[model samples]
Target: MGLALFELPAVSYEGNLKEITDQLVILVLDDGRTFNFKRSTNTKFFKNSKALKAAELKPGDRVALVAKLDDRAFLVASTVTFVEMTAERSAEIAAGVRRAQETADAASPVRGWDGPQLKRRALDEPGPIPDPRAGQSPSDDPLIAKAQDAALSFSEALPNFLCEERMQRFSRDSRMIGWKPLDTISAEVIYEDGRESYRNLKINDRPTNKKMEELSGSWSTGEFNTTLRNLFHPASAAVFQSAEYSRLLDLPARVYDFEVRQENSHWNIQVDFQKITPGYKGSVWIEPASGRVLRMEMQAVDLPPEFPMDQVETAVDYAFLPIGAAAVLLPVHAENLGCQRGTDYCNRNVIDFRNYRKYVSDSTVKFDP
Candidate 1:
C-alpha cells in the first residue's frame, strides 16, 4: 500500500527546542507550529550520543523528524537524521574546479588577431563539397559557405554581448507572506576560477508595490544556485541581441564582422562590439561537430558606474559522446569564479527564498546541438 503523506517522515524541519522537562522535548517550528517529543533511545542513527542529549539541540540546525499528531499538538517519536545544506556541496565543487581552471589559464598563452584580413581570407576560401541535381549555389545552401559566414559572424560578436541581471533579497520570515515566490525570479550568473558573479535577470509579469520595501544587495555563497540558473538559461542569447540594453555593455547593434579559431574540438569565435563604448572582448566555444555553445567568456570595461566593475572569469565543462547521428553535450561539471569580497557581510544577508518555479522554453535547444 502507498504511504500517506502524514505517515511518511518529514526530512527536515528548521526549529528550536522550546521546553525540555523530564524525558520530553518541545520544538517550535518556524511557522509557529509546535510539537512535543522524546528522542528514541533505541535508535543508532545519530553518530554522536550528545546529539540526543536534551541540552544539545539548537534552534537553527535542520532535523529530520518523525512524529504522530495528537489532539491539539504533535508527539515526536524519532529523530531520523540531520539535513545538509545545499551550500556545502556547492562550495566543495566550486573549490575543485577553480583550481583546475587556474592551472589551465596560466599554461595557455594569449594570442592576437587581425580581424579584417582574416575575414577576407575566409570569404575567398572554397565552399563545401557539392551535391548533384540540387542546382543550389554554394552560397544559397543553408549549410554552405554563406552559412559558415553567418555562423562566424555570430561567434565573433559573442564577446561584446552584455547581459543585465537583477537579484531580490528577502528575510527568513518573508516566507510566511507567500507573496513573492522564489521560483519566479530568473537570474543569469557565472562562476569560474573561484569567483561568482551575476550576468542578467528576467523579472516581469509579477506585481510590485511602491509601499513594499525592496531588498537589494549582493548574495551569499549559500545562494549560489540562484546565480547558476541564470547563466545556463538559453534566453540569454536573445538578451545579448537586444538593441537597447546591448549598448549598455558596449556591443554593436548589429554584427558585420567575425573570425573563428580552433581550440581542441571547439571553435572559438572572436566578435567585435565596436559601436558599444569600451567594446566587449569575449569568445564563444562551440562544438564543431554539433554547433552547440559549450561555453562562453566575455570581458568589458566602461560599465555604468552603479554596476559592479570587477573582473569576471567563468567556464562550463561539457562531455561529448556520439549518440546516433549527433554528439551530445553532457554537463559533466561546472566551476564558478571565486569571490573578491569576503563572505562575512554575505552571511548576515542570507535570505530564505521559497516557492521556486522554473521557466523553460517550449522549443528548448539541446546542449549538444
Candidate 2:
C-alpha cells in the first residue's frame, strides 16, 4: 500500500512491537499509528543492554528504535531496543512520541522536499539533520546558481569519448540477507555531441547482436547529461533547498535536497510494456566552494499500489577522469535498486564506467588476414 509521507525528528521512537516477520518488524505507537520497519543484519537488537536476535522480539514488548524513512516510504531500523513496559514508562514514551510529532509538524511547512534528511548516525557521533533554507527561490539561492551553472556546462565541457560500461546484476529476496549474482553485461558506450549510444553488447563476455536496452533485466541510460538537465534545466522546474553538510570522496560537500514534480519529470519507468513518469525527490552533493556535483541520489515517489514495482532508487557517483588529453568530470559508479510490489524480492544493478579514451573518427586498425 502507498504510504503518506511522515516527518519525524532524529530521535528514537518508542512503541510496542506489533508484528514481526522475517523481513520487517511492525511497531504500534501509543497513538495507535503503526510503522513498518525493514530490518537488516546491521540492525542492532537489544534488551536491557544485552544483544538479542530479531526472532526473540515478541508482540506486546515495549521497544524503542532509531529509524529513518527511505525513498520507499518505509522505515529502516538502525537500532531496536526493547524496554521494560511499565505503566509509568509507557506513559513517558507516549508523551515523547507526541512531542516529536509536534516538532516535526511545525517544521513540515519549511521542509521543501519530501525525502530522507538525516544522515546515518555513527557510533560515537550524532547524525546531521537537515537545515532547510526557508523562503528562498532557486534564483535567490547562491548555491542553486552554482549547481545550475555547473550542470549547464556539463555537456559543453566534455569532449567526444568512448567508454566501456560494466554492469553487474544482483537480486535478493526481501526476507534474505545478501545479494546473489545474476549476470554481468558489458557494452561499448559512445558519447558524441552530448548524446550517448551503445554498441557491442555482451553478456558475461559473450557477444550478442541484441541492443543493450533490449536485454531482459533492469537497465538505465542518460547518466551522462540527462540527469543534470532534469535538475538544472528550466523546463524541469525542480525545487531545491539546503539539506545538510556531508562528505563525498573524503571531500566536504554541501548537500541540497531537490524534487521534480511528476508533471515536469522526464524520468520514465517501464514495467512489462507499461511506462510511467513518476515524481522524484533526491539529494545532490556538491563541492562547497566550486558547486561541482560530486554525487546524486534519486527516488520515485507517490506510485500507485497497483503498479508492479513499489520502489525505485538510484545513486550516481562522479569523478574526474582523463579523456582525450583532458580531465573531465564523469560518472564513475552508479547503483540502481528496484523492488517488486506484492513480493519479497528486489533487483540491483551496479554499473561501472571505465576504459575511457578520446574518440577519433580517422583512427584505423590493421590486422593480418
* Ten residues in sequence with the least summed lDDT for candidate 1: 267-276
Highest lDDT model number:
2
Candidate 2 lDDT tens digits, 1-369? 998976664446777897777678777656434566787677889988999988898898889889866666556788999887678976787677677656544542221223222222131123355556645675688878888888988888889888888899988774435788999988878888888988778888888999976788899898888887677888888988776766767667777788999778888776543356778998888886777788888888765444567678888888878986787888999888887764557788999988787877643222111
Candidate 2's C-alpha runs over 4 A off are 1-138, 362-369
For residues 258-316, write the lDDT of model 1, one tens digit per residue: 11211111211111100112223343333333334433333332222212222222333
Q: What lDDT would candidate 2 get against the real structure?
A: 0.75
C-alpha lDDT (0 to 100) for residue 147 of candidate 1: 26
Candidate 1 segments whose C-alpha is farther than 4 A from its true place: 1-280, 321-327, 338-369
